[model samples]
Target: MQFVIDDVQKKNLTGKAVMNMSLGGSASQAVNRAIQALNNAGVVPVVAAGNENQDAGNTSPASAPNAITVGAIDARNDRKASFSNFGQSVDVFAPGVNILSVGITSNTATNTLSGTSMASPHVAGLAAYLMGLEGLNTVKAVTDRILALSDASGATVQQNTAGTTNRIANNGQL
Candidate 1:
C-alpha cells in the first residue's frame, strides 16, 4: 500500500482515486492495517472478493474494513458466478465472466478473463469517473456514491450479514 501511495503521489490530483487490487490472500492483521492506511490517505482500496466460492470474510484485503470488496457475476444473465466468493465481506459485484479486455501480452491484444479480479476494475474505473464528473472529492463520498448507485436487485445471493447483500456495480448512474 505504501508503494502504491508513493507512486500515485507523484501525480497531482485533488479528487479521490481508487486502488484496485485484483489479487488477494488469507486474512491478516498486517494486510488489514496496510489497507486502512491506504484508505486514510484518501484512496478507495478496491479488492477482489476471490474466486474460491467460499466466504470472503476469510480473505485478506477483501475482508479489510477499508476496502471495497468486489465479487463476480455473469452480466448476460445477471447471475452470480459459481466461483465467486460471497458473504458479508463483499461490497459489490460486476461483470466477470467472458469479459473482453486488453491482454497482458500486448497493447492491442484482447482476451477473455473471468474472476473477481476482472470485476474489481469495473468499480474502480467508475469511482474515478464519478469523482471527475460528479465532483466527489473524498474517498468516503465516492464510496458512498458507488454503493448508492449499485444494483442490489441483480443479486440472487445475499450476504451473510444482514443489510449488506452483494450489490452489482452500476456505472451508468453517475
Candidate 2:
C-alpha cells in the first residue's frame, strides 16, 4: 500500500488530505500508512470514526493516536447518528446530511449519503481552509486549532463508553 501511495503521490497531489473510504478490511494499517505519508508530505490526516455503532475504543484508525477521527451528527445536531462509532477516539462530530449539495459531480448537484464516512470531510475542509488563511503550516497546530474551536457540548453522546466520553471535555473548553 505504501508503494502504491508513493506512486500516486509522485504522480499527483501529494500534500492533500486523503480519506480511506473502503470498509470490511483491516483499515488501521492502511490508515497508519496514510498518516505516515501525510506526515512525510506535511499534510493533515482526517479519518472517519467508522459506522459500526460500537464504542470507538475498538475501531481502527479512528482508534489510532494522532489521527483526527470524526463522528457523524444529523441535521438536528442533537445526537450522534445511529451508525456513527463513538468512544474516546472520536475527536469531534460534524454534519453528515442525508443530502448534500456539491458542484463537483455537476454544476448543480445534490447527493444523498449517510455514515461517518460522509461526515469526516467537513472537518477536513475546515482544517484545510484554516490552514490556508492562518498559515498554520504544521499538522499539530492545525489539529489543535480545530479541537480548540469545536463545540464540546455534543461530546457526551450515550454511545460513547462511560469513562471514554468525558475525555473530550477534559481535552479543552468548548
Candidate 3:
C-alpha cells in the first residue's frame, strides 16, 4: 500500500490515477495512515469492504475513512451478497456475485468469481472514467461526483444491514 502511495507521490499522478485495493484485514492504523496519505496526494483510493459478513468498519482499508469502501451485491437482483460486509464504512455497492472476468490459464479463458473485491473494481473504474470525462482533478471532486451519481433508488439491496447506504455505483449509462 505504501509502495503504491509512494509511487503516486513520486510520479505526481494526482488527479490522474485511481487505486483499487481488493485486499484487507483487521483494522490497522498503518494502513489507514497510508490511505490518508494517498488521499492527501490527490489520488482516490477504492477498497473492498471484505467478505466477512460483518461490519466493514472493523476492517482495515475499508475502515480507513479516506477510502471509498465498496460492498457486494448480486447483479441478478441487486441483493446484498451473503458474504459481503456491511455498515457505514461501505460507501456503495456493486455487482460481485458470479462476475465473469479474464482467467490466468489462457488468453481466451474466463472465470466467474464472487466477492467485495470484485465489486470494488466497478467503482474504481467508474472513478477513472469520471476523472477523464468530467475533468475532475481532486479527490473531493471525484468522490462527491461518484456519490451524487450513485443509484440509491435502484439499489434496493435485500438484506442489507443497518448503517450502510442504499446507493449502488453507477456509470450514468441508461
- Local distance difference test, each candidate: 0.81, 0.64, 0.90
* Cα error, candidate 2, residue 110 (Å): 2.8
lDDT of 2 by residue, 9-97 (tens): 67764444444432322446666666666666655777787887877657667776667778777755436778877777787777664
TM-score of each: 0.87, 0.70, 0.94
lDDT per residue as tens, model 3, 40-153:
888899999999999998989999998999999998888899999999999989999999988999999999999998999999999999999999988889888888888534
Candidate 1 local Cα displacement, residue 169, angstroms: 1.0
lDDT score for residue 113 of model 1: 89
Candidate 1: give the clashing pairs. none
Compare the candidates by TM-score and give the number of the best one.
3
RMSD of each: 2.9, 4.9, 1.5
The positional error of residue 149 in candidate 3, measured at the CA in angstroms, is 0.6
Which residue pairs show backbone clashes in model 3?
none
